[model samples]
Each structure stands twice: as C-alpha cells, then as structure tokens.
Target: MKICCILCDRYFTPDKMQIKKLRKHPHRIILCPECHERIAERVRKRKKLQSLKRHPEG
Candidate 1:
C-alpha cells in the first residue's frame, strides 16, 4: 500500500517496509528511508551529546 511520509511529505510504498504498527496508525503515515535515516542520525547525535554532558568523557 502507498503511504505518505509524515516528515518529508513524500509518498512511498509499504512494500519496501514491514512495520505493522506504523501501518495501522490512524494517519497511516510512514517515513521514507532517507528521512528516517536523517531523523535517526540526529536523534543519535543528540543522545550522545546528552550522555557526554552528564558523564564528561575525556
């Protein structure tokens, strides 16, 4: 089925994916690979920075 990426507003087919939860969501919105990767990378960097702020790694 075709779903729109909530973040990038691009349409993509769910054939390339298999996330049942997202598929069943009310908006039926999904993230394209490129947008998902970019968001995940940002979140990873933010989490790493938060950890360093708390631990102060040398």
Candidate 2:
C-alpha cells in the first residue's frame, strides 16, 4: 500500500505491520523512514540539551 508522509508529503510503501497499524488507527500521522529518523534524532538532541541545561558540569 502507498502511504503518504504527513511531514514530507512523500509517498512511500510501508511494511505489512505499519499498514496494519494505519488501518487500525486512521488518525495516526504517517512519516517516511528518513523523516521519522530525522524527527527522532531532533527529539534526542533536544532532550540532551535540556538535560545539560538542567545539570551543568565543571
């Protein structure tokens, strides 16, 4: 099945499991692998920055 990424608006073919999830939850946001990785990395970096801001070391 061809699924469109909500962020990039690119069409991609997801695996059976992903398709199942989309079918089960139609309201879920779909993202391509690249966009997903990029977003995840950004989240990780943001979390790290927040931790450093909370606890600074000499």
Q: Pick the candidate with the highest lDDT.
A: 2
TM-scores for the candidates: 0.69, 0.86
lDDT of 2 by residue, 1-58 (tens): 8999988899999988889999999899889999999999999999999999999998
Q: Can you write out model 1's per-residue Cα lDDT over 1-58, one digit (the tens) per residue?
A: 6677888888877653446766566555568888988999999999999999999967
Off by over 4 Å in 1: 15-19
Give the Cα error of residue 14 in candidate 2, in Å.
1.0
Worst 10 residues of 2 by lDDT: 14-23
Once all C-alphas are superposed, what RMSD does model 1 give against the true structure? 2.5
